[model samples]
Target chain A: MKILLYIILVTILLATSSARYGVVAQQSKVREYRIANEHRILEEFVTLLSIPNVASDHVNIRRNAALIIEMMRRRGLEPRLLEAGNSVPPAIYGEWKVPGATRTIILYAHYDGQPTDPKQWAGTMPWQPTLRSAALEAGGTILSMPKPGEKIDPEWRLYARSASDDKAGVMAILTAVDALKAQGIAPTSNVKFFFEGEEEAGSSHLGDIIRDQKLLEADAWLICDGPVHQSGLKQVVFGVRGDTNVDLTVYGAKRPLHSGHYGNWSPNPGLILAKLLSSMKDEAGRVTIAGWYDDVAPLGETERRAIEEAPHYDNELKTQLGLARTENAGKSLLELINEPSLNINGMSSGDVGALARNVIPTTASAVLDLRLVKGT
Target chain B: MKILLYIILVTILLATSSARYGVVAQQSKVREYRIANEHRILEEFVTLLSIPNVASDHVNIRRNAALIIEMMRRRGLEPRLLEAGNSVPPAIYGEWKVPGATRTIILYAHYDGQPTDPKQWAGTMPWQPTLRSAALEAGGTILSMPKPGEKIDPEWRLYARSASDDKAGVMAILTAVDALKAQGIAPTSNVKFFFEGEEEAGSSHLGDIIRDQKLLEADAWLICDGPVHQSGLKQVVFGVRGDTNVDLTVYGAKRPLHSGHYGNWSPNPGLILAKLLSSMKDEAGRVTIAGWYDDVAPLGETERRAIEEAPHYDNELKTQLGLARTENAGKSLLELINEPSLNINGMSSGDVGALARNVIPTTASAVLDLRLVKGT
Candidate 1:
């Protein structure tokens, strides 16, 4: 009993000491980071945004690659241009080594944006940055609209093609490193940057480039390619679900048949495909595949604990998503992202628009994405 | 023990007698169906084929409806047209009472063909019917192709919008009744023909018509729709899965943003929608919806036994369908078809074809069909 009382006393003392240390650290937090060179980072971002780096547009892509190389060299980093034959645009690689750092981090960001249809955009062109009031969770910073007359405030975030997806991520990383440099606090670890022009095109030749480049090696890979949490809190993703694209085609008759004339007699590929898809999972969302669950890796205790610990709003989410009720396994957001998944990305065949055509489509195809976790 | 033995013997004897009867019935199956007048049937089918009843074209739809009414009148059957105001073409109801019939059977079919994109059909006109040789399960059958003057034949079936669909089914039903008249063999059951016009439009107003019409009343409804089995065997369908269409839309921003710039920070509605869809199903094809199966009815013992008794070629079917394995229940076809289903019919938001787009889709939508069984 005396030993137990003494241990409790020590625990309380340690807890008090820890709390005090945390308070001191919070009080010493820096208010401003590199004010003298703040405009320079913004200038570099605008410069990168100025170039049109739409996917498969080789000329602009090459120009952007050169510009990125120049930016890296200006920061005293060794940057190189790597090519992957003719089909894919070239990639840019840069490395900054800390004198005594053993660990290295690789930052990946794509520079290209989807080709824009001017009519679909709200402004004159997609290449120009537009700014507007966006939700805090969606990047937080306010920005200007891309219209010709729209003026941008220095404090405002820029909105443009290739602006947020990856380019913004690229700029943020660069700025973070630059801020550290201004404080005379060099990176605590070796850092590498890989900017690719073909990520939008499924990163067609990225694996090849990664395989060939010795300098691109890293202890950790940080993919700047997804959204921040909906709560506006930044998260460190330990891993991501790898994806493979599946194009499924169901062939019916050689031509589109009238659903009316063939309603009961001719094959309806749409209905057949639907049945086939539904068969995979029961109404309860349980997969009915033979031996499908056998190979799946069970959730780890850590992941389970995280899921239980996380704040959840399943009921609210269901209402917001216009769902009558939350889906199975949707009780936790972590489970929704961590689990293996199959999605019917797109489905097409026959007439399914304004004017309904009673067509038994000859061929029905569904574009699907299967997200596989590390285990299965 | 003696009584048990006697019961077993009696059961064996009864089973043997029933088996013998089944074999005899199978061996001496009905070989032919006679039409009242083959020439008239063919001529009418040909005339109906010539009328271009393209969907959404009201003038053509009305013309076809008139022809159907005229045919019923010529056959000495009293027919009435029920038009759903502000809706598509009207439904045609024909009734004939066979003297001394104890039961009633309703024949349901639609009269509509898919609209033709002239560019799709080469050297063939949508309205013209041409004689062609099509290999049949019973051998080769000379049938009519969509366009006139084409002599080429395809194996296993003729290719026309309405050939094997309801139009042909309608012809089959009409020919059967006509045969009864010619042979002086009155139908054992009262005949009610409900030929619908808007069946091609999801038979949208048929429910209202069924509720409103007294003349169209019947003990049982025989939907002469869809197709015969792939094996070309006659099938009696007692049930069909009912469907509900749901359209989903997800909004990320007021406008599409460049994926490169906002890829990781701003919400990509396309990606969000894709992730949501993916979450609904897993790699083995399971829906992940929470209450998706709340009202699902389980298969009964009799249904399970029927499934076991049903003939199936799972391996052959998998190979023929180019599937590694069956998706749905992964059970027998009978078992699989006995359940409800959810299918992604169409999904669209951004550019879907040709090359991949890297922009964060501002909005995305998917059309889904949820199929329900009898109880659900």
Candidate 2:
């Protein structure tokens, strides 16, 4: 009887080990596929960039969306164009269902780019791609801050429109899938692709798309629009912060009051707004809203551990950022990058620069972007 | 012997009490003088507002500075005018000595006002001081945002350039001094005034002057620039945030690149800069710079306690702020307002608005305004 019990235990252990091995093998295949097809991904991204998909004048927005759909269909995937809103360009969705897969993952990217100006472009037109020696880069239209002890490698850059912002990312995703199919490997989990065209214009219609379609039901959602972090490490991002944009107007008198007469007695709405904003935060980067942090989600243990484990630069890297010191000192890189934030995007009051006037401005408007953490 | 001792004690106690009462009586007199002179302060503010002291247009700025100096001399104070810079306007300095005073406070105000457009002002010009009905307080160039809940009381408002800014504050200080003089009361502390003309032009030369002149020495500085808190409470501010403006350019190639050919491989500087900025701050208000907060002076117990004790709006007030929830939702008013912040004052790349082209911008630029707290 003891021998029989030992045999059963051994058998169970062997089966569990084999299953784990299979899973590891599958993950390895995915990694290998992505690595080998980097060049192919680059090519595809270049092709997409060739298309003029400027958001405001969207002559090519639909064309690019259709092209993406065609690519997906050519790979034996069922793809559809989703007209989420009246004014916005359509979203392209493609799905591959592996029979009996219990989980699903959705990939997202944007296909639109900002319009170009001919005057701003020096070597090549805004639409034409150009290559330059690293030394010539400094003279290009875009100016980069000279970093200490840093040398630019001209060969590494492919200068063009929409390359890094999102097109490259999109290409990376497609190429990654294409590589898997070429290797005769079927994905373990069902996959869905979402290509949006309105991200450049605030994604104004995205919320509606999310609510109405119910089409993107998946176990996980992956945003493929952002670039790889500076460290160039393969990242697994679990969450993103929510955002809200606000325009606040503080009204004073019906008209602009003379600063001389009303400076101390009557209120200057601009100063009032400044004082109000100042009251919301202190010198140490702590927020001052009455209940601003009451519901803030604390960093979880797993996240903290992962962040600590991630590769990071020391003082040398900090200097590259031109930062004498970090803002939220002592926090890990991951914590800072993944956390939520609030920012004053822009503020306009009266005249600015040589045109600055001392009139107590009648109206001061500020554009604020507030970012929220996943749990908070 | 015991009775004699009691008698002596009683006499000493009476003498001490009388001395204390004398000091208290003097303080009450001064307080009453200030209160009684409130109307005079308003009147002086209005008078100052009548002058056209637009900084951009030089003629009135010097005139107003001269007027301020003349007024100071009339008050038995020594006034001097110093050129801000060879190109900029002049600044006025005034000093008064109070016998036996151990402390000195520097008072700051600007004489220049913002330029006004005649087309925007209704029923009055920018330089004309008009007293409209109590229901109409806003009048000037289209710059000023009207004060909320500000009763358009003709009795309260003086319509002219520089009405509520430094002009009115300067008038208030002068009027306060006048009231004290009339009551045969003098300032308990030595007073020094630093009236600036180019403050409307960024106070560019003020820093150099502050560093060079011992004539402006004082124990503390008082900047009567911005208004009181939105709650109408009187506040004594101890510090002002310093600002640094940076124009960052992203260099791509010598010329704008066509999006089609090099989209994936080319380095688009605009996209790069945007990504760079986006990466610096996460969804939360936290900046991602390493050690950014190390140099920041933490809020002291005394300061925090004082801020907590100060009057503040709770949930109802926040609701009135038009916020469903505040940014950094759990922070105190003191914590959020006093913190250092980075603002994207403006960003330009290719075409930002309706004019969308497909060219890769050669250069992208962004204007950054960093608000510095203590240690920054």
Candidate 3:
């Protein structure tokens, strides 16, 4: 149960469509090797998923790291936590040294997840991983835990906070290591595992931990994050855009005032915010803020060529997202993402809907997410 | 105490600077008549203010009406409830017929107040009116209710939901009657009182009640609402601007998505809202929307002359409100108020401040207040 839960559920989720659907037409190596031992991997994955892993959740985050450490211990990998501070989410580190391996590579993944309002998730909680017969949008049905002899459908999805994120990356890499040892395959390279606890939290302490810990040294590192491709094919991302957040606030009168009494006189914070935010973007969705796009580096020939060669799925994506249009007018999604971008993640002022009142709010605030390309 | 509480406080609040502060230099009619009976009026005002009188709160709204009904009964005026519907806030109606009166005037005011969020009120609750030595922004000190014989500070300010709004209007009109009876003065007008319970809620049922109740007949409806001139002088306003509210909302992807993953590819609702709202107003804060100002009636020579003659206190108001700028670049406050105006009372999308997350919200909304001049 432990073996199959850890190996099959999470690891199989993000595998290429070829690997995922190959079982229906013909048995893949994973099916052949684990056909009789499927329940073990399913159980191990479920147990690990049970722990809450929001980066901001100090207690539950540590609990998740502890469980990963124990899992590494059972596999004869001496895992140690590399932390910059007691409160910071630690980076769990371990390595397998091959007898005559010359190349050293580090497999990197984050155990932490984006902060979530649990109410946003439907039919499930962030930590309470559940198996669905299909995607929720496609009319999925919840399924109970399969007994040892029960059939496990490969198309069934596990819905949870970190299901498709780097948590699945952690399990996939670990399972790969397990498969190598089980097949008595000798390693061609020295393998090191580094599981980060705060990638979703901006990885603020990641550099500090890497600088402090000597064991994290590697010739090359492959970060397992983000998505594959919209076509369900695997794509190795070379570099990710840098991210930063800005919290902007504007003020009105010292107190909430009747809009009718002061509508033409008092400056409303919400109107001020709208004007200010609008000033940052033009009609074509290009940021109008001064110096916004001035610092971004130009894309090189090789990088531009790679983007041109990538799949063109903007039209398909727009249809799926129910959007008749997207930002940056003529630019494709691939090309647009390569440049620096600004997006308003959230905004708030006074109240709306049921609690709406005819009064000018005291203040208005917005959370802006800025994504940067190279050199930006 | 009973007589003073109802008369001195609310009646004196908006009675011009002369009536409010004339006691030290010269005793006004209100002060001279209510000197020994001051606490009675205050207690009554505070007790009425204590009731939750938001129009939407049906249960508490009726409680407010019942209290007002009893207050009128004790004053020897016959009061009756005028309701168009069962759930609608009832209008408290009463009248006094002076035998030799020629002019008949309906003293119109609203008892219901703007919906309040308690968190916005500082150092006090909306329903718990408190005595303050000065305005809250002026570092006012909270004071206990003055005893009957104790001196009442004519300058002291009362803080609560409807303390300065139409509720104060209700008490003022009623107290004027009390003052007449106590002083044995015969009023020259047949006075009628129509205290509406939902003016702040747009008075949807106001026309309905007035049409149905034959007792509401009067030569003129003197609406005891809004404020005095900015110079703290009484100004008899002729006609008021009409008001309407629009709840505007924009949609995004059906669910919240990780901004870093989908930001550039997906359109953000907040940015959409910002751009949309900004299009409705220009840099000079003039409405840019098509036909927004086309229907507004042109001001006549009399109205324009009145605006020109009004005291110019824009600079003083700006300094007091901590504003370095005002809307409609060249327009004065008096001139702007005479025209139509649009204000964003509140706006919201996802969360801000502490609960802010790195997710693209599913929707963004704003409450727009449109105040129209005559013919609009």
Candidate 4:
């Protein structure tokens, strides 16, 4: 009993000491400020998410930009719209200059989201910003937004099309600035905000926007996109894989033929596409295309070490994902991510389930997304 | 000029001799009858095609049965409905008894058609029975129905869901009877007409109906359904492949995940399914499954000779289909059809084209059709 007490006392003393100095001290201060204004931050986020912001939706996308500008203006930062030309969704730009700061950090986030079919969404609509007790897949129930005096649960998720993808990034960055101001904490570096409006449309005008805006130049860029780690842990990804999409279509007959009458005689486009795709990748998940891996650059020492040091959570992930086995049996996920990959974003031929008919479709199509590493 | 005249005279004489004693003589009588009452026959066919005869639509299916019964009665034959139980779609039965005949032949056709989606139909509605100059795929234009004095083109096609499938069978059979009676030609065999109302629903109660109806017994059954030969030549199929459908689905994460964040890490269901299906067949279009071809019955000497004697129109077919190559490279389509085959009737994973989102879908599914030969 005496030893246990002693151990507890030592733990408390060490924690208290760490709270007074080091990264823990800074984190504690940020947390306190965030907790104090969590409700307001969440409400603002909900409002932002309620806007329909598909990149190709010109009217709604402009609305998103206007609202984001208002969000920056409320913080006393003068925001401007950066556009390539007329009718294009503009980038919202703002900056906070710190006196005596030697570096300028550009914070990047996108406002537009991927196009979604309304019929594909579950009970909630894409732009409705429905709050759920948890994830919908986890039997989450919709909850009414909290009133002014009510406390909120951090675990509750706001369900919307871009709730997690990029709107969350914008919300988090803006909230972090609010927290710093509320706590009277000064940032060591000048921060510039660059909220993009057409990332989902492949950022076609991003180069022009950057080239035309001279003030956007910074020492380094901190991009806030993607999701939290699959293990629900915070992670920092230094480099992102470059993406290229290819739309592939295979042809069968000129018209759909009854499967029973001409199945074997007619070439099935779906099977042809499958065979073509299979030829590109082997059973071990390695791509077999000629010259596919030839141009890949060797990993640097730092990258190699980082991969080796990363957690070995494949077993835990497999259990959570309900997978008995993964492709490329023995390779770790950290090891796999560093390599180039060929993934099928979407594939279709005829129809399945209730809409399925016994017809050999005229064409089968697949959208393949190739994620390139540093070299290829 | 004298030599040309002599050649023409010889050609005319030979053609007349062949028409008098060859297959043309048998076809000439049917042709004369069809040509005499073409307008009425076409109008009757259009009226029958106008009825929605999806087997599941009980009211429409019964209406089809009643109309068919009326048609048989008009020809002075006794007609009745054969049913297993109440509320089920019944088979329309009618018979023409030939005195002193040693054989009875049953002419089988179905009134019910495959369920159709109105939106999937081109130009014409499922039961509207519109006339077209050609197939919709061949850029056919909708044409007005012929008036009493208007000349009808034999090449013109009637467009409806079941226009050519089985309704055409019903119309042709009845018209043949009319032609025979008008020409004072008697059929040697006692002809029995059996029109099923639920063929598209797998003829679930056909066995029961046959067992309950004593007059259904016949020495021969001539089934009139399916398409004309791909070569547009009259052909008969002696045996049909037994069909079995298997639905296959592969799993990914429990919910959709951003492809950018977890693409390489998360096993994509589409890719997994593609790999699985690819494993079933080789590059040469031969199934690699352990027992896929093991149980296939070998073709007899007669069947082999028949296949060899069939017209080799594969080159013309390939050109029409815009195919540079076919599966099982050197083998003829006739040889391939004799073997049991596997085909993907339909497959789906997420959405393609504009509706496609950058997410790894939860599941990918495929409808696989396996065509079986004897002993398989």
- Candidate No. with top TM-score: 4
Cα RMSD to the true fold for all candidates: 14.2, 17.9, 4.6, 7.2
Q: How many backbone clashes does candidate 1 have?
A: 42
Cα lDDT, model 4, residue B57: 87
lDDT of 1 by residue, B62-163 (tens): 888888888787776687788776447788888778888877877777887645565565444666654444323234445543333332222324334566
Order the candidates by DockQ, highest first — what do you get? 3, 4, 1, 2
Q: What overall lDDT goes with each candidate model?
A: 0.57, 0.57, 0.78, 0.78
Worst 10 residues of 1 chain A by lDDT: A1-10
Poorest 10 consecutive residues by lDDT, candidate 2 chain A = A1-10
Per-residue CA lDDT of model 2 for B25-52, tens digit only, reads 6446545654454444445555677777
Report the C-alpha lDDT of model 1 over A167-226, residue by residue, as the tens digit.
776666566556456656565668788888877666779888878878877787777666
Report the C-alpha lDDT of model 4 over A111-194, residue by residue, as the tens digit.
Answer: 999899888888989999888888777888999998887877767777887887788778777777776676576677788889
Query: Relative to the unseen true structure, what is the Cα RMSD of model 4?
Result: 7.2
Collision count of model 4? 0
Which portions of model 4 show Cα errors greater than 4 Å?
A1-39, B1-26, B53-63, B73-77, B84-89, B115-117, B181-186
Tens-digit lDDT string for candidate 3 (A51-142): 88888789999999999999888887789999888899999999888887888878788898877778867878888889999889889899
Measured against the true two-chain complex, the DockQ scores of the candidates, in the order shown, are 0.05, 0.03, 0.55, 0.46
